[model samples]
Target: MAGKLNILFITADQWRGECLSALGHEMVKTPHLDALAADGVLFKRHYANAVPCGPSRASLHTGMYLQNHRSGTNGTPLDARHTNWAKEAAKLGYDPVLFGYTDTSQDPREEDPESPWLLTYEGPLPGIRPVAMMGTWPTPWTDWLKANGYEVPADIRYAYGERAPGPEYEDGAAVPRPLIYPKEADDTSFLTDRVIDYIAESDKPFIAHLSILRPHPPFVAAEPFNAMYDPEAVPGFKRKTTHDEEAAQHPWLEHQLGRKLFRAPAVEKKLRRMKAVYYGLMSEVDEALGKVFAFLKESGRWDDTLIVFTSDHGEQMGDHWLLGKCGYFDASYRIPLIVRDPRKEADTARGTEIDLFTENVDIMPTMLDLIGAEIPVQCDGASLRPFLEGRAPATWRREAHWEYDFRDPADDSAEKRLNLTLHQCTMNIIRDEKFKYVHFTKLPPLLFDLEKDPDEFTNVANDPAYLPVVLDYAQRLLSWRMNHDEQTLTHISLTEDGPVTRRAARY
Candidate 1:
């Protein structure tokens, strides 16, 4: 009992929880995850704190919401002073090794002589050593191809609507193609190989976060899995209502096609290929995970190691006509979360599915506490150990908090004025069980009833009948902000008339 258990955290980039068979999505076969679920707990109601890579990862690592971290934009980097999970783990005398990235936002002021991004997580916490950082992958696979003389021509760095071969990637190397042996050659497969190797050594109890880069974009899968899922077999998302029927309800989806990028005949073909490739990548990712799991079992560490499976966030696959996560819709925030408590708790494993809402923030503290490490008292996140112990505490919370900042680009001086740009101003979200309230600063807020309109086809934020519901969620949002966010005097300022200020404040 005194010896610490190792932590194997696996995260898939932009992976939807519904894509795997374990989640009842019949199309994709995930035998590896299905068995893992059978042996442990699977969360049925887990949500990401933010959509997209940078901010979502910030929240997950710090156990602080975006409101607190203030690395508000994709390009905005988290303050170097922040505490991260790996740093925390090190404090417990365990080596907290980060196998991949945290997708931390790039800082605005680059080329700093002492760059914060280059440093370790807020200075090591203890027992953890942030090593073997197989820096941002998939891109590296393209690099590996380049190093090997293959002319791959797709920027897997970012993928949006109707993309064609571009400057960075010219040939089909970056495009979807059949690999000789997917299990042995794909990018995800290589990453799994690294993980298995790390675990095999098991020289000491280690905390390894094996983050995967596929299922994100470029949607290209390796080999047989590339043609594995028949687009015909996978049904298109059921349309509850027509898009043209609702004007101004969701214009974001329509603008995503980028008609300029693809000429006449290529649009539909691009869409078909994109979806097929995305699912293929999912299958390939699952195969890699299967190998990792098999190694864990063979090493006899399966029961003792606590495994966590989740993703930074979800992707919007033509949903609402959007290609990626740019809105507060369910397709963007609903991520997969599964916690396999240390095998020592095997017999005591109680419930398999937890319906209560859980946010990515809860993960850090929960993991910290489970491993007998100290959970910071000030963290806004609550440890979920009780739920795993088969005792749903009476005070167990049932909701999650999410926020996005929408800054108005029209304000040129916005960055200097408030220490952030317009992309940093859109603070809005879906909350409670059925209501979504979006506060767009100068713009009108949005409200959606998830229970009544699962498709979010209506904007009830302005409806007087649901005004109370909006206010209730609004106050809860504020409470969440107050608990998580931290602002400094420099971040705010006083205006001539009164004390008008510009800063990132939670409440």
Candidate 2:
């Protein structure tokens, strides 16, 4: 085996930042991840730069913000010119292996319009070597389920806890049910098995990106897990008692509530049950990760591997009366970030937690920094290598910033519904220690004093007393946007002898 250090980058979809027991989450118990944090550095205030799957993963892979990457939504094409971590790693002589999916919508310019990849946003990113592409509807896993003697549904989505297996509830159930497949053949277990096999068969140092899609949707779990949590014991939602109360906060909240996407059902029992199922799914993923950790240790690669565990974006999961990832709420943007660097210099920083703000874009640069690769000029993220080595950067970011583009090119539903232009269906958020400011393209702004209203129930944008704070954050957001404009080739210049280049580190 080549002696290059291995990179194990793992991502869980729609996982909340506050769901980890290691981070003092009361309801969820994440023993596997907790152990991981015991040997890793945890970023307490990490956030994703974009929303949904495709766009968030775009920021994560390219080390660029939503504005820079321009892959704003699912099915939106990622610009072919931009280089991702996988493409960069390939140049460094490491074959980036994807065990699960990247949720990258291929650029239309590089593909035939009639191609199958163009029909869906679930395609792998350019330059990523997908060993097994398990996504929203994993065909490979479904085929494995069939071979394992389970009755496969005509539409695999049904088997994802979307509907009951009985003929009576073939379409869907009023309440979700356990998946038809057993625990052994479920998505998490299937992906884990494939990852273990890949590690076992590999002889060379590998760059493995394992994206786990549990606790993201369908909110269902198999056997022992489905019955593991008691719905009654689940923590209460951190939201107003009624959806109407939340909708009254802002125009966007009203739009989201009217769409009925984030608004929970009226039934208390159903909502709690769904939350319980989501927690169970998290536990299931944690269990699956435990196996992978064991594989790394037993295979004698634990000390040589750099492990990164995070999520693309966070799920609302009934927080703020929301179920999906949208709006400027912390629940939809803040996510867990744990990095376990095996270098001896990082020993003192082990089990430590950093409260400084970090974003999803920083991940690519951090990975690149660890592997001794040059971070690209286009990346707007900074490396966390300093924190990993028990030292904090002198000029670290003081606030967390994120952008969400709600435009739908295929159909301008958000614009039409919100009574705004296509360009107006966008927003940016700037969150610091004491306050969070949300600025929409055309809609009224939102300001929350997080210290007083941590649940973000009250919006103080119109309050005359808080105008100074609002103005300060608004200017900060604007300056941040202007400062981070794409620098792909701006750092290079033509010269008589050759091109003079200013590296990303210089800028």
Candidate 3:
């Protein structure tokens, strides 16, 4: 409290909360995060608003539920008319900064004056400047290598195992193990080095978000970690074969690309190796992050800094026979979240974990609350500070929410659309302490009693006995949409000075 506070926001691309040792995953070691948790608070049941980068981040940075600001996928651009945290932070005299890219794409309607989604697509929210907007993850790695005098391959990506002499698929190497220091330097290490350097010189009340890429595909790790775990050592996904088998129910996963791409044939052995490498990559991130935290502690800035650790979303790994996150399942939507308040409270619940439902969408509001900034009235998430400090608002929803838009027909031909047009096969999920409801727009809905089907092996949505349960969830889902939709259903008036103007419903 002696100086202007610093906010260290660390976000990984697709990290699973269960992957951390602190969370009971014995495979990975996150000592620094563990240490921070010792002095901070960890949320055991946090989820993501959406999966696969863009949409998820849109919700995170904007503090809005997916329904309110629907950028539903990676290619969809968020509408810029809304407000974002960094923009508001700037008004508070703090120079909010971003270290990595915000996958938020430009709304096509705005980009192309004639695009259909234009009236439909939301644009970027205002505020926050990316101090370092390395176009994509590759740009950051390449830049770091060059700056450090390391020669990086222009062909930045390579597959782990060769698939004969074909066009190189971005899938990573076949070998999975512990972290191996590169002949020069690893991307994970390099990015962290840059982050450490930036924090060292930063004198402002910095709000830095370090977005890491790893354990994502390209499952390659530096070394040592490259060959870390034995397949058997890493737990097998609870439902693999059944998952892909079920994919037939969903069009996107059944498409040619989805089918052909992955470590398939259920290579249990290879998967273990892949997971080992994934863990190795994770450790590398942990090591890099530890340095940043250590520096803060050593510089005596630790007390004034608030650090939050979470991922944009969770990866499916081999869960439900899927690779990466693109579904409405737990592996794809559930993420990890830890908030380390710099005050370092006494009775400081070190390694303290809360099971209350939480999600990345709540992140911005939490940060705003800590900085004493005004959270926009339109925000959907409640501040996490209350839960982190062991307080839960009575109004908090017992169930966490997540959404998925079926693929746009033009791009990949999915069935979630009304008639297979530009829209996607949409699925909405509402997860509570024990039950989960996954409602696909036109497809068979899925329901699970998490208490019994923790792995989600049983789909009860079709069971007659569970019809009532399904109805309850469906109603909730509908209510959620009605409360948060763009208000496209009704005609309202907007006043310029006195009142405004009125418009009729177009759609």
**CA RMSD for every model?**
7.6, 2.6, 5.8
In candidate 1, what are the lDDT values of residues 1-507, reduced to their tens digit?
A: 334788898898898767778788867777777777777778887888885677788888878777768766565667766677777777667766765666675443443658654443222222235454444324545555567665554664432112333321123234445443334655676667777877788778878888777787656666677667665455565333444443256433233233232111124445555677788788788778888888888888877788889998887676655567765777778888888786445447633777888889888988888777766533557787876767675665547668765343444444444354555456567566777777655455678888997777788977899999889887877766655555334445577886765533121
Deviation of model 2 at 55, angstroms: 0.7
What would you estimate as the lDDT of candidate 2? 0.87
lDDT of 2 by residue, 1-507 (tens): 223778999999999899999998987889999999999999999999999899999999999998988899898889999998888878878989998899899988999879898888999978889888887677888888888787877888666764445531123443336766677888899988998899889888889999998888888788667757777778988888788887899978887887766677777777788888888899999999999999999999899899999999998878777888997999999999999999898999999999899999999999988888888887899999999999968777889999888887777777877899987899999999999999998899999999999989999999999999999999998898988988888988999979998664522
Count clashing pairs, candidate 2: 0
lDDT digits (tens) for residues 424-449 of candidate 3: 36778888977988886665688888
Model 2, position 16, has a per-residue lDDT of 89
Predicted candidate 2, C-alpha RMSD: 2.6
Task: State the displacement of the C-alpha of residue 488, model 1, in Å, after optimal TM-score superposition.
Answer: 13
TM per prediction = 0.80, 0.95, 0.84
Rate residue 480 of model 2 by lDDT.
88
Considering lDDT, which of the candidate structures 2 and 3 is the better prediction for this target? 2
Q: After superposition, how far is residue 128 of candidate 3 from its true place, in Å?
A: 3.0
After best superposition, candidate 3 residue 460: deviation in angstroms?
1.8
